[model samples]
Target: MCSTKPIGILDSGFGGLTVVGEVIRQLPQENILYVGDNARCPYGSRPPEEVRKFLFEIIDFLVAQEVKMIIIACNTATAAGLEEARQRYSVPVIGVIVPGSRAAISATKSGRIGVIGTENTINSDAYRRELHRINPRLTVTNRACKPFVRLVEEDLTDTEEARRTVTAYLQPIQTERIDTLILGCTHYPLLAPVIAEVMGEGVALINSAEETAREASTVLSVSQQLHDQNPQPQYKFYTTGDTEYFRQIGGRWLHRDIEVASVALGG
Candidate 1:
């Protein structure tokens, strides 16, 4: 793959914008092509095999677009399909879970880290596995906050109900004495305010977005695949569902409104 070719990224929906924002912040010179599987979004609740299928579909689509590197920006999809994507695709395929796990390890003071994500993610124990892979002695607790995604997707992150939901979902983790909490799902970062409020000032809320970008930088550097020239990065967004809603909510998520085109599945 050419070094100057756009880096491809995919998420279940608009949540991956968090990852895109971080990439933009740290690697302004690199180009990116992003896709959100909005039509069949919320991969969190699906069966592992189904999630894996969806992930491959998205990755296949990105590769068809001639992506140099691919980032799986969704926790659920990463849990389901990252390894398969790596094996199936010729290019490097990276996921958010490992980066988030490493960040949690570094951020935890008490060695007790809590991760809140979708039900499938928590059940799959992806975070727990990776966190233990790094430090076997650390204590890890994972909970699934299924509603947070809907809240963020609906732009209800700051609502009173959002506050209540956050408090309810995170109370158990707080009582567990976790000093670090991983926003395991990319979508969860948009609910950081509510999460922080409930967890209080003591716990460190780790957003893996920046860490994931760092991983990308490391991979590119180690492989001598870094893009040196300041080329204008092209960002194309395709939504399987409502392109208009994606453009609206997603533009807000990125703090830069742009056009969103429609993408078909199994085409």
Candidate 2:
């Protein structure tokens, strides 16, 4: 594999920009090709089969771009399709669940962990299973904040309504006395302040954005596929929804101007 080939990242929508932000921070030399299925934005409410199908469609698009590796940045898509994507693709495939699960397991002092994500991710039980796989005695509780994605997409993250919504969603999880909480969805990190306030200072919130980026770095290093010598790296963005909207949110998250183009997937 060529070290200079770009890494492909896919998400259900703008949420993946969270991962992109971290990747840009951690792997500055690497080129990134990101695609947001914003047209089908919240994959949380969809069926597993449908989500898997959509994931593969995006993966095909990424592969066509000649990406060196693929990162499935959506927790719901990672749950529904990570294993299958790994099996199908020749390139390295990384997902958020394992890194997030590992971080939660490593951070907890009480051995009790809480996870908040979309309904699909919570229902899939991916985080719980991954956490248990790492440490069987660890306890995991999950809450599905199905509306959090919408709050992020609509740019309502810092508003009073967001705080109220976050408080309402986190009330039960806080009662669990968990020492560590995993923001299982990529979008949830944007609401970290509200979540932290609701959960209090005792709980350590796990944002897998950085951890996932580290994992990707490790994978690239192990495969000897890192673009360490590349002084000028390219970053490209594509969306299935509105290009300008993706560009706006993505730019805000990445702290750089983004130009996004639309992608139409076949039926």
Candidate 3:
């Protein structure tokens, strides 16, 4: 059965735009409905239970919108709620962690990989567990770059402070000489350039957004639910924070003008 319903994507804030961009590129025929919980952004520092609560709230909103699939684009949310969300929701729920782990596993030649994500995600050891589950001998280094989320959310990626922060956070991982580095958090891709510079040519940066989008495409194709007839796909953006700010940042990242509406989720 073919379904034309929009694919729902949720992130703590603007980070998921990375996934949105990939989805637009890979699944251009599919409509997209995105929610960014900016008002309660940076789920990284929050407890697992709290992050799960926020994730379910946003997922409930997307489910009510009748989306065919839901992508939890936030690493922390995925670490906190991916399994539960899959069981709770009838629609297919995809997470950033597994796709990223698979991609990193494929990219690494030395059997050593580095994962950089939020505090909660790193603490949960989601990527480490996923990578090890695939290959027990693989050396997985995990770093919690919590401030990187704030930098991307605040649109400070191009600043010197951002570079310094990136260097500081990645220094330990750099010394480890991991052959592949997973940009575990969706937001971390926005800082790819600086991270690349700091980590140098030896480390391959794996952006989860691209892999996640590919996974979404594969899932829809396998299930025969892909929207193949839509030539002009519609996109809807909602944010719990400032609409204009989201529009501005999202437009800059997406390289096109986007219409954003303010939405308040949960009582």
| Candidate No. with top TM-score | 2
- The reply for model 1, stretches above 4 Å from the true place, is none
State the C-alpha lDDT per candidate.
Answer: 0.86, 0.89, 0.92
TM-score of 2: 0.94
Regions of candidate 3 where Cα sits further than 4 Å from its true position: none
Per-residue CA lDDT of candidate 2, range 183-219, in tens?
9989888899888888889999999887899899999
lDDT of 2 at 105: 79
Cα lDDT tens digits for candidate 1, 1-267: 328878898998887899999998888878888889988877767788988888888888889988889999988888888888888999998999999898888888889999888887888899999999889999988898989888987789989999999988888787888899999888888888888888899999988787898888888878877777866666788889998988888888899977889988765
Q: Where is model 2 more than 4 Å wrong at Cα? A: none
Judging by lDDT against the true structure, name the best candidate. Answer: 3
How far residue 1's Cα lies from its native spot in candidate 1, in Å, is 13
| TM value for model 1 | 0.92
Cα lDDT, model 2, residue 128: 94
Model 2: per-residue Cα lDDT at residue 57: 95
Q: Candidate 1, overall lDDT?
A: 0.86
